[model samples]
Target: MTTSFLPQSPPAAEVRTAAGGHRTTVLIGTDTYPPDVNGAAYFTARLARGLVRRGVRVHVVCASPDGRPHTAERDGVVEHRLRSVPSLVHDSVRLALPVGVRGHLDRIMERLRPDTVHIQNHFLVGRMLAAAARARGVPVVATNHFMPENLFDYVHVPGPLRPHAARLAWRDLGAVLSRVDHVTTPTPAAARLLWEQGFARPVEPVSCGIDLARFRPVEGGDAQRGRIRARLGIPDRTTVVFVGRLDEEKRADELIRAVARTGADVQLVLAGHGAYRGRLEELAAAEGVADRVVFLGFVSHEDLPDVYRSADLFAIAGIAELQSIATLEAMASGLPVVAADAMALPHLVEEGGNGFLYRPGSARELAARVDEVVADGARRRAMGARSREMARAHRLEDSLARFERIYREVAAEGAAVPAGGFTAGR
Candidate 1:
């Protein structure tokens, strides 16, 4: 709705600082990257490319694209795809098994001489990247996107052993993150969560941004819109769209139950694939509203805008999201939101301005709130306009500007911190 917060890229010749004589180069390390379809993967990929667009040379180290380790560069962003194995525990995630990053990472840095290293997550790759960078005073910046409890439901950890496992996980996360120069999460509430966990470092909140141009109100003609609505089987009914993995922590089952309780001819569209799909389907059938629920597993990026535009409102039952990129996209696409009040979602969805917030895991409360939007056409459009207005401060360029400032600051400070490793890579 507002591009005022968006930063304009400097002219081609202005890429370098007046004194520096050259553009800064950044090394972005991550446990995930594109084609993985999650927030971390998508954000990491975008961050690298976004930096490149802003006159920064970018390099990335990420999980292999196809389960095999390889190195490649596309669109001027050099990438080192390390060895990765599919996570049997959680099929969607991957584990990077860099046998000895201490040795190889030194070689990479010696050749690239990056201004700074930005690592995503506290996984194996991030731990090794942060260590190798800090050992040479590279001004490491770490961003956390993990929630232990969200993942615990997927693995087969016994109930009695859960407490100790969590304790060990936290211990490991702290050990890896403590060495970084700075830390960030997608929301301030998430920053507080990290603070409560005793993360004794600077914790900043930076949003995982969406491409506003790509997510704006769809531009299809009337006929096309009609066909899309018919194809989605929501010809003239109130459609509530939920876009996320069908995971237990997402609390998608609660959304289905709430839709059933609403009994207001509202349709629910589940727009991603996950391990919990079968259970959600079963729940829908049991609630006798299976016909009202549509599962369009894994919508493509090109087609996602249409899905948001075709809907009357957007809904998410998730409680663990630090920033719901889909919710932001929906807002950009001019739709009202209904979300859980927990975590950072409340930061995006104002109680009445944009939409409503229901108590986490409360089907009746969710239903009551959603029904309010469904029953009133005028209120829905007004709230949607408010949503678009609220999303202005979170534009992608604004986030990029924040990171650019962080990179410049770190790069300057990196020069003062003495390198802790051998300078000459023999």
Candidate 2:
């Protein structure tokens, strides 16, 4: 069961700190990172870059394509790529654990002796990294990103078998989490979920920040709107945008159904790609709303701001989201959101304030909310303004500052019981 997968360890001395007395180095292990473009990847990338900005040297350990072992510095962050199995649908990869690589990681950690190890995913590589860090007496911090429900979509397990699968997954996760000095979740809802699953680690709730500068709305005459509309082939009348993976969990299909229910002359633009694209397309076609729905798969990072800006409103029905980064981005772009009032959605979407919330899975209610926004230009404008102001609070720097504080606190605490362990049903 034990095998070492790494080719050869890079010289231990090869790893060195860059400018600034940031002597603190953090190793972020995940199954995905930049060039992969998922939530986990985006979070890790931003966190790494943010730490770099604070003068902390960051080293990323992530899965890369086979035979493509490489090293590079991005935004002052160093990435050490390792081989992984390619995902079937998306341009994603899964990290392969090798016993040999664990030794390499141990050597790297011994030399770097990073102040802390931050793990973003609870995958095989992450577990191995956590164990390695523990063995080296390095402090560990883990960010819980994925929900157990997401795994059920990929595995062939039946609904009845989910509890067992979830229990096993959480048990293994608890093992990795117990060894860590601290754990963080994007939202309180996620933290609660962790607690319910029997994880006794201190779980802090901190969100990954949104970039206010890039996401703010632009002030322009009809000319700008006209240009954006022309480019998107959307009529200037009304348009609703859903920016996220078009997966069943995201409920893009639900949004489409809601839009169809509205029967309003509004275009529905579906952004992001996933395994459920074809099914969503089929649903849209069957619903006879195919002509009204536009599929814009995998938008470029640079174009995301404009995409949000071009939309008249943003809507999401996914109840499983810990915190919808897309919703945050949309709000940052000054777009009023119509989100499900379940899980973490209510925390962000304040009804009649910055955005509106419908009951989770209620296509009729979602449709009605969409109609409300579309009908009142003045109300939408007001909500959009509030959204911009609210977004300022969650800027990337602020979020990073919170994390930086946690890092310092955890490092100072030394060996002790995790402070924030969850009490059942708290």
lDDT of each: 0.78, 0.76
Best by TM-score: 2
Off by over 4 Å in 1: 1-21, 159-163, 218-225, 231-236, 415-426
lDDT (Cα, tens digit) per residue for candidate 1, span 1-426: 000112233345544342366777788888877666577777787777777776788899877867676778775679887777887777756777768555767888888888889999788778888878877778888888887776677887778988778767766777767767667888999888877665656679998876777777646644565677776555545688888777787889998999899948898987888878999999999999999898888565556777888888899988888788889989988789999998889999888899999888899999988899978878888898888888887888888778988888877766333222111211
What is the alpha-carbon RMSD of candidate 1 to the true structure?
A: 6.3
Q: What's model 2's overall lDDT?
A: 0.76
Clashes of each: 0, 5
Instruction: Give the worst 10-residue stretch by lDDT in candidate 2.
Output: 1-10
Would you estimate the TM-scores of all the predictions? 0.89, 0.90
